[model samples]
Target: MDPRARPFRSVLYIPGSKERALEKAKTLPVDAIIFDLEDAVAVEEKPAARSLLTETLKAGGYGPRFKIVRVNGLDTEWGRKDVQAMAFAGADAVLLPKVEKTAQLDELSEMLPGMPLWAMMETPRGILNADALAAHPRLEGFVMGTNDLAKELGCRFRPDRLAMMSSLTHCLLAARAHGVVAVDGVYNAFKDEEGLMAECEQGRDLGFDGKTLIHPAQVPTANAAFAPSEEEIDLARRQIAAFEEAEKNGQGVAVVDGRIVENLHIVTARETLAKAAAIAQLEAST
Candidate 1:
C-alpha cells in the first residue's frame, strides 16, 4: 500500500502478547495498530507473541485500520524471526526498533522484499544518522523514540518538551525531505487527558504526521489534533475555487481571502480535502 495515502493521525501500539488488547484494537478508531513484539513484550513471551500476531493477522477482521508488526531490532535473536513471521503473515509494514544506521535497513530490505519498513529513530546514533536513514530507498518512515532519547541525553521533562524540540524537528525535516511520514512517540501518562492533548497539539505544530498512542483513550485526542480544522477546510475550499477560476481566466495566481493563491496553494488545498474525505469515510464505515 502507498503509505502516503493513509491518514495516520494516531498509530496505536498494542502489545502482541495481550490477547484482550489485540482483540479490542480491531474496533478502535485509530488509523493504525502496531503489534509490538519488542519492548512491550517480555523476552520469554517473544515466541508466543510472534505466534499470536501471525494467527491474528490470518484471522483478519481489522476493518480499515492499517496493521503493522513492530519487530525487535536486528541486533537481537528474536528480530530475525519477527521479520520472517510478519512478512509471511501479510502485515502492511514491519516496524524496526532502535535502528542506528541505513545498513541495518538494507539488511532487512533484502529479507522482506516488498514490505515497507518503518525505522525507530530513538537513540543518539539514530538521530545523528536521521538524514541517511530517511534517504534509504526501503525506509518508508520514522517513529521518534522519545523515552530512550530523553534517557540517553539526561534530559528532564519540563512538561513542554523544550529540551527535545531540536531533535524532534531534525527528524521532521529529514522525513519531509524524503517525503516520508514521521510519527511522534507515545505519551506515557495515559490517564492524563489534558497532558495528552497538549502533547498531541505540540506534535502537530512541530510538523509530525501523527502521534504514537499507548492507550485507546488517547486515540480521539490524537485524531483531533492531526485533523484539519473546519476553518482550515473552508479556507482550502475557497483557495481551490479561486485557483480554478484564475486558471479559467488565464491567470497564474489568484487572490483568496486577501491572500495570494498559486498552484502550490491548490495542491495543499487538494490534500486537505482528500484527508477530510478519508476521515469522513472512515467514520461513516465505523
Candidate 2:
C-alpha cells in the first residue's frame, strides 16, 4: 500500500450470511466492505457465509471498492477453512479477528503468501503485543475493536471513551511506527448522527486514517470527517505554492499567510492535496 494514499475512511461491515446486504453493500459508496464470517454469522451459518463470500468475490463488479473477509480466529473450527477460501478468493485483504501474536501472523503469512493481513487489536494479549504484531512483514493494517476491548477490560462504554483512549492511541502509534494504516472502531449508536460525527472527528484528531462503520447511514459522516475540507485544501495549495516559489528564489523557507512555511510543511501540504484529490476522484467515480 502507498504510505501517502488515504485509506478507506468508512469500512462498512456486511454480514456474510445476508445475501441481500452483501449485494446492496457492493453498490454503496463505502471505501471497503468487510464480509464478516465471525461474529455476524451464527454457528450453523458459517459454512454458508464462507461460500457466499467466496462466490461474491469471484463474481466481481465492486469497482474501486476494497474487499476484505473477516475470518474466524485460528482457534475456532472454521478458522482454517476461512483462511483457505479467502486465500483463493483474491480478496484485497484478510481480516483476522483476535490476533494476539506475531506467530499467528507467521502462520497466516505461510498460508497466504502475498495477501495482506489485517489484525483486529481487540484482545488484551493483542494489545500487549501490538508493537510486535505490527512489525510483521505481511501485516498491512489494524482495526481497533473497542467493543470487545471494553468488554475484555471490564470498562464501561462511556460517551467519551476516556478509559480506552490511551490504549487506542498506543495502537495508532504502533501502526504509524510500522507504516501501517490504523482505523478506529465502529460507533455503535447508528441513530445518533451528531454523536457519530463527534466521534469521527475525535478519531481523526487521534491520527486514525479512517473508521469502521456498522451502517450505511454513517458513511457520509465518516467521509466528511476524514476528508480534507475546502479550506484545508486551499491552505495546503497555498503552502505548496509558497514553498515552491521560495525554492525558485534560492530561499530555504517562505512565509505563507503571515506564517513561515518550511520543507516539512510543504510535504504535509502535498500529502493533504493528494488525499483531497483521491477523495474527489473516488466521489466522481461513484
Candidate 2 C-alpha error for residue 21, in Å: 0.4
Across residues 69-160, which tens digit of lDDT does each residue of candidate 2 receive? 99999889999999999988868899999999999999988988989889999998999888998899889889999999999999988878
TM-score of each: 0.95, 0.97
Q: For every model in order, what is the number of clashing pairs?
A: 0, 0
RMSD of each: 1.5, 1.2
Query: What 10-residue stretch in candidate 1 is worst by lDDT?
Result: 1-10
Q: What's the CA RMSD of model 1 in angstroms? A: 1.5
What is the Cα-based TM-score of model 1? 0.95
Cα error, residue 267 of model 2, in Å, equals 1.0
Per-residue CA lDDT of candidate 1, range 242-278, in tens? 8898999999999987999999989989999998998
Cα distance off (Å), candidate 1, residue 131? 1.2
* Candidate 2 Cα deviation (angstroms), residue 228: 0.5
Off by over 4 Å in 1: none
